[model samples]
Target: MSLVIGLTGGIASGKSTVVELLKKKNAVVVDADWIARQVVEPGTFAYKRIVREFGTQVVGADRKLDRTQLGRLIFGDESKRRQLNRITHPWIIFYMIRDCVMSVLMGRPFIVLDVPLLFETRRLLWLCTVTVVVVCDRDQQIDRLVRRNHLSREEALQRIDSQMPLQEKAAMAHFVLDNSGSLLALEEQVENLWQQLQCIRKQRLRYYKLFGTICFGILVGIPLCRSIATHL
Candidate 1:
């Protein structure tokens, strides 16, 4: 089995940078954002359900989901957001698990599940060997969002406020990466964390092997003891 790491961060956090570094180290990544888009593609089951729930206005002329328009629709509407999640989350989870299984079959040492809403959903937490959250200060996050998305300050703040707070996420995570400094600093932290995860993986493998050996001995010993008792 592979060490499955659930990776998440608030918008504009440097989670992508860590993911790229992990990729360089040969970690297999299962990205939820990519799967979310795939599940909502033109004729997918989630797509059909979305159209039925949100109507045709959310669809573009190219027969693709106008994600921007749909975002606008659910921006401040809690009920609509839940409705959309109910439609797409199941399919996303299905694809995520499939990819993880394939990675395990191929003998990946570790698997990174890049899920933006990992903490919010908490549905896939059980599958993770560890959970990591990347975070920066609120001001840094807001500034990054403003520059990256070309949004005004107020807009950036609003986007940041929409999701669960970074602090809250960090509190729940098994490990927290503080990305408020230089790229080299963040890279160093990631490397250290990777080493720690590798140690954990080895420990788990050893435990599983020892457990199997004990069970095998118990099974064999029970039959041997029964035969000896019958003869005596």
Candidate 2:
């Protein structure tokens, strides 16, 4: 069985850097953001549902989702945001699980599920053998968002505030990758994490094999022991 690692972080907290390092280590990385975009593509069930619920106003002239428009609508309104999550989160979870299962069946040693909302979703956390959260100071996160996403300070703060706080997520994680310092420091953390995950995967596989062998021995010994008693 493959070990499933749930990777998550607050927006702009350097989760992508950890993901890149995991990829370099040949981990099967299933990105939830990529799945989110694919599931909402034109002609998808999510696309149809979104259009029906939010109307064509959220659809562009090209008949595709106007993500910016949808974002504007949902950002301030909790009800609309919940409605959108209701439509898409299920499909996202379905695809994420399917991909992870496929990886496991293919005999992948481990998989990294890069989900932005892994902790917030609750159910996704149960799927992981280990949960890793990338963390940075709130000011650092806000600055990174402003620089990377080009959002205004207020907008960046709003986006950050929408999710579970970084401290809370870090508390819940089995492993925390701190990105508060240099890239080299972050890379070192990832290297150590990769080594730990490899060790964990091996240990889990060893335990499973031992357990299976014991069960098989018990099954075979039970019949032989009964036969010997009968002969006696």
Candidate 3:
């Protein structure tokens, strides 16, 4: 059986970095962001839905959904963000599940689903055998978002604040990849997890077999004992 590993974290929490490391292992990496974008490509149902709701302002001269335009409008507005989520989240989840199932059915030992918003919508959690949450210090997350995305500190914080806290996410994760340190250190941790995961799976299978054997022994022994006692 294949293992589906759901990878998630807040924006700029080094989730992408962790995904890069995972891909180095040759695991099938299904990035939800990419799937989301795919579902919104010009002729997609999601694209049609978004355009119908948001109108032409959100579309460019190329007649495509101007993602940056929509981002500017919705990133700071709660109602708008939720509206956009309503329009696109369902389709995105559909593509994510499709790709994940395809990867697993192809006989890959593991599939890494790099879903940045795994917890945000709570749609794909059921597909995961194990969920790995990549995290960094809150300060680092804020700083990276502000610098990389060119958002103000307030904007960065609001984006971060809109989701589950990193502390809470860590506790809830089946595995946590701390990305506050150097790339080498982060990779070391991932490698360790990979090895330990293999060992844990092996142990689980062995335990299952052992349990089956013990149950069978007891089942047979009980009947034998009863028969011998009756004969005596």
Candidate 4:
């Protein structure tokens, strides 16, 4: 059976970096951000829903989502953000599930679901047997977000504040990755986690086979010994 691992992190915590490295290792990486964008393409239900709810002004002349404009709108208000999430999440999860099944069908031994809001939804537990959370200090996260997204410190902090905190999510994660250090350190942690997971998958199979074989031998041996005792 294929292993489905959920990967999550707070904004700018190096979760994307981990995903990129995992791709280099040929692991199936299913990203939620990409799926969210896909489901909202010009003609999609999600697209129509947003245009209807927020108005046609959010759509660009190119017939696509005005992502920057929408981002500016939703990020400025909690209610608008919720509205956006409500419209996008159903379609995102729909394609996520379908794509996961397709990955299994395609013989992907392991599939990683990259979700930024994995902890908030709590639906990941239904499908993911294992969860890995990437984390960093609040200061580091704020710094990275500002640098990567070209936002002011306060804007970056506002974005981070919008999601579930790293501490809360990490508390329940099967594995926690610390990315507050240098690139090499982060890479080493990811590599170590990958190796540990591989070992666990193999050992779990070995344990099942070993226990089954032992149980079978005991059943057969006990019956034969009982028969011999009766004859004697």
lDDT of 4 by residue, 1-232 (tens): 5778899999999999999988887889889999988999988888989999998879899989998778778887999999999989888888888889899899787789999999898765678868999999999899888888788887887789899989999998999999989989989998998898788778767887999999999999999999999999
Tens-digit lDDT track of model 3 for 90-191: 888888888888877887877888887787667888998888998898899999999998988988887888778877777878999898999999989999
Which regions of candidate 1 are displaced past 4 Å? Answer: none
Query: Per-model C-alpha lDDT, please?
Result: 0.91, 0.92, 0.85, 0.88
TM-score result, candidate 4: 0.86
User: Is candidate 1 or 2 superior in lDDT?
Assistant: 2
User: Candidate 2, after superposition: displacement of residue 153 in Å?
Assistant: 1.5
Cα lDDT tens digits, model 1, 178-220, are 9999999999999999999999999999999999999999999
Of 2 and 4, which scores higher on TM-score? 2
Instruction: Report the error of model 3 at residue 10, Å.
Output: 1.0
On lDDT, who's better, 2 or 4? 2
| Candidates arranged by TM-score, highest first | 2, 1, 4, 3
Give every collision pair in model 1: none
**lDDT-sorted candidate list, best first:** 2, 1, 4, 3
Estimate the TM-score for candidate 3.
0.85
lDDT of 2 by residue, 1-232 (tens): 8899999999999999999989888899999999999999999999999999999999999998998788778876788988999999999999999999999899998799999999898868777999999999889999999898787898788778889998999999999999999999999999999889889988998999999999999999999999999999
The top-ranked prediction according to TM-score is 2
